[model samples]
Target: MPANRAFVLNSRPSRETPAGPHNFRYVESDIGEPGDGQVLVRHHYLSLDPYMRGRMNDAKSYAQPQPLGEVMVGGTVGEVVASRNPRFAVGDHVVGSGGWQLYSLSDGRGLRKIEGGTPMQAWLGPVGMPGVTAWYGVNKIIAPQAGETVVVSAATGAVGSVVGQLAKLAGAKAVGIAGGAAKCEFAVKELGYDICVDHSDADFGDRLKAALPDGINGIFENVGGKPFEQAMLWLNPFARIALCGLVASGYDGTPTPLPDVRVLLNTRSRMEGFIVSDHMALWPQALGELAGHVAAGRIRWRETVAQGLEAAPQAFFAMLKGGNFGKQLVKLVE
Candidate 1:
């Protein structure tokens, strides 16, 4: 049998010392057989998300930390090369938490069989967790109304892109806050955002406020820091904030302080922080909604892919630094 190449976590990363390639060790092992009730998957794509950084630490979190001396945890879409499981068959495409490996052996628990309505890679992106995340945050938390103003940070990313489109679909003015001019332009021109502000600019706060003459009724906060803090200054009465991610804090573990304490009380704003997996029952509904939007061309998504499994570590590090444009993924197979 051909060797199964994988990256195993060798050490834990901390707030003071961030993780790097040194924390992982590459190994080659035999591609073992899958016995009865098991399936062998050959991963085609692996998702690189910000949450994986949190899993690298051994501290208490909403979920268990990634165990050391094992394959690093991640989402993957692949083909079942071998299956003794009755639910799965050879040549079947699947999506699951398959980790950072060329191949994986599974008992077919969380693995979802791909039905081919949408593109396969999208199961890791727009029609998948990111899409469901956007749908839930916008509809359940942010709850934008017609003609209201909604804002999303990291506007061109997988989740943020979908967030903006969904807000627009709700008849709200979608405002995007992204890193550079190029992304800002894409948010407005392609994603149908009303106005997209460049957060990297020196006068970003002023520009953001200027773009929102009506103030913010809803916010899908992906990157919380100075950008989110600036956006907070213009919260409208009874505005809603869906706290999806704090990209900066997730990496280094330093909290970004938003000092405008009185706004929540003054505006009666509601801020809800969520983990998408917690609401398992809502996923089917949310995914169906998202897939329909995608089918109708109401939702647009993008991806940035790295070449191979060996490049997963560096790609992940780059993605954390905002080097990626949309959904950061590694193409594990040709």
Candidate 2:
């Protein structure tokens, strides 16, 4: 039997990204066969996100942090190559927390079977984790209504793009804030956001105010930094903020402190931070509805795929720096 080649995090990363010995190691090791109640998966695509940055540190969080020298954690779409479980069979298409590796051994917990006949990459984007993040945050959390105004940071990302569209479907005016003009343009033209503001603009705060004359009813808060601080001033009474990933603060060398909580209190609004892991039971319902929207031409998505496992680390860092156009995925194999 051939061994699986895996990308394992070598050490705790610094803000500038630890280089050489401080970063990652690729090693060839035995790909263990499935034991009873387990399945052997050949990973096809891996989803990369800023949240994984937190997992690298030895700190407490919503989930157990990844230990040093373990396979770096991530989500992947894989084919069941060998199964020791009655619930799965050979060639089954499933999604799991398979990490940055060519193969994974799972005991069937936290595994989701993908159907709907859509392209597999869609599962890594709109029909998968990112999509669910967008849907539940907007519909269930934010609860935007017709005539309301919804704003989203990281507007061109997998979750933000879906967030903007789902807001529109609920009859609200959707506004997007992205890094540059090109991304802002895509948010407006491709994603159907009512207004897309460029966060990189010199007068971005002023521009956002101009685009949204009315106060915002809901905010899909993904990137938490300057943009989040600025958006805070524009929220209306009873505004709901679905605080997802803090991509901006997560990458900074020094920790970034949030603005005053008095602002949230003054506006009579609520901000809730969540991990999708907590909402696992709602995922099937979310994915089913999101895929139906995609099939019906209501929600759409895009992806930037790096061709191989070797490119995973680079692609991940690029995504952190706002280099990816849409959902960032690494093609691990096949």
Which has the greatest TM-score? 1
Write out the backbone clash pairs for model 1. none
Q: Which portions of model 2 miss their true places by more than 4 Å?
A: 14-21, 251-253
**lDDT per residue, candidate 1, 1-334, as tens digits?**
4689999999987656678888999988997999889999999999999888888888888889889999999899999999999999999999999999999999999999987878889999998888888889999998888999999999999899999999999999999999999899899999999999998999998999899999999989998888899999999999999999999655566767775779999999999999999899999999888878887888877889999988999999988888999899999988
| Local accuracy by lDDT, each model | 0.90, 0.87
Give lDDT tens digits, candidate 2, residues 102-204.
9999999988788847887788889988998898898778999999999999998989999999999999999999999899989999999999999999999
Task: List residue ranges in candidate 1 displaced over 4 A.
Answer: none
Q: Highest lDDT: give the candidate number.
A: 1
